[model samples]
Target chain A: MSENTRLRPGDTIGILGGGQLGRMLAQSAASLGLKAHVFCPDPNSPAFDVCAAFTVAPYEDLDALDRFAESVSVVTYEFENVPGATAAHLDAKLPVRPGVRALEVSQDRLFEKRFLSGAGVAIADFAEIDSQAGLDAALASFGGQGVLKTRRFGYDGKGQIMIRKPEDAANAFQAIGAVPAVLEALVPFDCEVSVIVGRDLDGSSASYDIARNHHENHILKTSTVPADVSDATTRSASAMAEKIVAGLDYVGVMGVEMFLLRDGDEEKLLVNEIAPRVHNSGHWTQDACLTSQFDQHIRAVAGWPLGATERHSDAVMENLIGADVDGWQSVLKEPQARLHLYGKAETREGRKMGHVNRISTRTA
Target chain B: MSENTRLRPGDTIGILGGGQLGRMLAQSAASLGLKAHVFCPDPNSPAFDVCAAFTVAPYEDLDALDRFAESVSVVTYEFENVPGATAAHLDAKLPVRPGVRALEVSQDRLFEKRFLSGAGVAIADFAEIDSQAGLDAALASFGGQGVLKTRRFGYDGKGQIMIRKPEDAANAFQAIGAVPAVLEALVPFDCEVSVIVGRDLDGSSASYDIARNHHENHILKTSTVPADVSDATTRSASAMAEKIVAGLDYVGVMGVEMFLLRDGDEEKLLVNEIAPRVHNSGHWTQDACLTSQFDQHIRAVAGWPLGATERHSDAVMENLIGADVDGWQSVLKEPQARLHLYGKAETREGRKMGHVNRISTRTA
Candidate 1:
């Protein structure tokens, strides 16, 4: 778009996916006096309940996409897996923030690794594996151990397998439908962390405090801010995030997951992956900082000035998976716990029902 | 209403009056997984843009009210002047939180003063007046200085006149449309302050920190939390708020405005007015406290437990009236300023277009 693409308060923002993230982004838009129109196929999408308008149609429906684009000044999505064709279609009509290129680069694992490496971002070693034989060959080169992941549509430990032993690789490619994939040597990292960065249309960028993440069952369980890393490590992580966003010409908040490796106090970071939208790890910003990632994302997509990312308190955000949300009553009673429910109808196993942020005065 | 009238996630809340207060309430409800359906006559209501569903019909439209009541599990209002008949109509169908009596008492200044005095709460001395002679008589009894206010439907210093000297009261009665009114003794002591209290269905109550308010052109200009009051004054203000809510059998958030009087080294507080909804003074809680007044109101009306009311930071909430909202860019650039625009289409004079909350780490 143009440098003067800033939206006024009453402008409508079209969101492509209607999930918890979209639900939050819509709410943030409303807080700033802007309107949000969510588009999703699911009638029961949580976001539909909070937006000003919505269209229930598949991404492939060009007519619906056209109408949605007409109603909004800009378009953005909650998830990174938005079809490339869909983003291009909307981009042809209105500005689609983070641009279609960000989606194209982040959609395919091989492309993502190559782009990161080209941009001078530190990442793990990996190779293309189109078949079981190719996977086996790539695994042997990485000392018989690597993560075999599909090139597209993988999330929450799905579409990937850990091939630790020879037997573990047997039919691993077939198990993933033998799709074009990438195999990367799994780094023995000290901890997992992420930085959420917001880049404006004018190339101004701001990054929130790094969050040290923890996973259970390959699903994110908790994210604690003010990551227990050295000041140099924090600075390095932020620089990498800025570099990645600038590399993609990104114009919204992006979550950059990284692996923090420590070799006797000599810390290093490897870019793990990039989400071209708000990520679950950054939810703590909602309560711990003056501006949330959702707010920052909306501001960026609207071409408004980016907000300050300084966090006033230390926070730990824990996801309420499945039945964990049943304890909302007790959580409400906790003085420092800020609960956020996704308004999903059912609590299926492993589904992200909600999350809670527990905060305390900064000690460090 | 039953003893156990708790509303679960995914339940719909019907909100009356589609102004900025309702807009913020709807947004807060969404944050906790509840759907909000707003009802108002104006097609241009700002809250309509944020709610899940909205009815653009007058409050007297019984058929529309029935349809709206059918679509939600419970009902609440953002303003106190929600026609008693309309509130009574919905209360018969389902729970109308803060109940009909709370609305009735607060709707009339005479009734409100009587209720507070009956509840043994400290309040300003006042007398009812119906004619120019009556207003003149009441004014004389109060040292020829008082405020002649309409008993009902008065807000933002509207429907009231200050009778300072004899000539100021010449046409004051006719100026207020000759409505049945109450003349209150003019308070001349100190600062204006307010307390927001949330009472749950179980008769449990919580009070936020007292806020010292500043007004311009009879409209609220700013509210500073942790009002510059002594501990004794603070405790008194909070206790008065709790007493008022309990006396009204209030089951939602209520704003209580008071006048602080300083006598030598002693501090005194007199009840000024009561707002049976989330008060503007409490907006600071959205940024400085774990649970905002809007969040607490939703929880109360939903029959859920109340969250903590402790503020973690010092906050000053300033309303952006009319064209003041045009400075949003500068506000966005302010590191500690949190901006909230009401999405109003026009910048009419005296209109509350939005607000900004600036916070600092608590020092006292």
Candidate 2:
């Protein structure tokens, strides 16, 4: 990559996704006098509304991606599933922050587990499976219950299945299309938490306060800042996030989702996954912190100094999924709630339409 | 006017004028899922980049203005010099918040002073000057010093001249094109302050805390929130803002700038001027308040409940002019400073390139 190091205010950032994340990132970039050029295949991309420029094209089209890369000073993807080769291609022309390796590891569950486990991080007990026999053997090793998950393109509980018994192993594997997958024993964690960390070009890094998350049907419903975890757990989460980012040689904001195992005296955090881009769990930071995770990510990608992660107020961010957005007027009526709605024309079930960050000075 | 009073999330807002305030207002509207359609004569307007749609046409182009007005649910303006006839034309198609009265009263200095005075609001003693001889007459009416100002289209101390000496009156009048003007006695004030108020369609109103201001070269340099004023002064300012908005039967946000005079036993606030739209002095609220001024304005115009204007933290907002914006790097390095840059392609001296809102929990 041609490392021009730091980017100035007028620099253009090319975003690889056009969802609400990209829309918000574009808004943040605009605030800093930076322009955003979003490249997405969807004609109805919400990000197009707020960005200075955009192109509608498939990611597999290398020539189109190159033209986009030529226009922007730096490139960043809002999702981890950005093709590694595409990022590498952009990197050859300009800086692609968080690097291709972060994408490579996070996009595949097996690679993510191997990378996290190798970095002295505690993750779920897992074994990879490529065939029916492999699935059976892994299920036996897990003893009781284990999840069979396809190693790629899984989110919001898709591409995964739970095997509760030996007989259910083959059915679970078949249900997953018998693809390359991982079988993992589920841990009884007290709560799910995530820490969003930003690393600058010089390797200086900082993490925002932990957000304790709640999921409805395996989709994130709410994220509350000042997670109910103890101070020691927060310290451990911060340290682990720092270590993981350094290990990947990553720059830009990365979210670390973990399961907090509350085994009495042996309270520990087990790494569930790594999202090498801004995560929904950190949405509360937009209202609670001095700098939002989106702004921090933009700053990191621009090679600017990392902003403070201190929480200025207590906040709870709730996702407005599909019909939940029907309550937008009520959300608007709430004096302390800050409403952010993605300008999406469609409102499909299970789709993230918007979110509200309710802010207060009262801490947990 | 359509009289579709309550604007839902998906509604469109059409804005007149396309400067930084228009740009910021478009951005705020986007956050709430409302699209902005801007109409301005400048093709290079900053507001165009962030809005969903735009019409580049002169305000006198009645057909173009009507078409633009037809596409939006409501019409609001960023600058009061929105050409009264053009505003009236738009109002004929849809409800225009902070209506024609706000534009009429604020666009002309004489009308503004008269309206405020009629509402029992305190203001400087002033007289109208239609010619050079009229300037001399008004000068004599005021004992020593006065400011000669054009009745219309004056901003940032432009189209105005300070007549420090009696001999300067005719020259100042000629300098202002001998246009219809207002010559006001220069009050010996202690400081300048402003308050931003939002009034909803239902007449419910709220006001952000007073902003203490400092000017350099007739341009705003900085505004500190929770202005160092006595409780009575703050209350008086709030009451006056509410009274003015209610008197005009206005909706959306209005900024009232005042000159504070220190008396032997009383502190007085004299109305200097009123901005019908979002004002630069209220920029601090973006970082310090629960709801930003822009957001409050959007909510008010949308006919949703007005947001809380309570200040969450103390803040000092500093305008970054042409050369001052070059210090963006240094500002970015300050962890707690929130930077907002207007995306103007060129950097001209005295141009408002951006501003920074540095926030802290410490109150006044």
Among all candidates shown, the one with the greatest lDDT: 1
Chain B TM-score list for all models: 0.98, 0.96
For candidate 2, what is the recovered fraction of reference interface contacts?
A: 0.68
The local lDDT score (0 to 100) that residue A144 gets in candidate 1 is 95
What TM-score, over all chains together, does every model reach? 0.98, 0.97
Superposed Cα deviation of residue A267, candidate 1 (Å): 2.2
Q: Name the docking class for model 2.
A: medium
Stretches off by above 4 angstroms in model 2 are A362-364, B2-4, B362-364
Model 1 steric clash pairs: none
Q: Model 1, A1-364: lDDT tens per residue?
A: 4335689988999998999999999999999889999999999899988888999999999999989988999999999889878988888788889788899999999999999999999999999999999988888899999999999999999999998898999999999998999998989999999999999988999899899999999999999987999999999999999999999989999999999999997999999999999999999999988899999999999998898898888899999999999998889888788899999999999999999999986532
Docking quality (DockQ) of candidate 1: 0.68
Interface RMSD of each: 1.9, 2.1
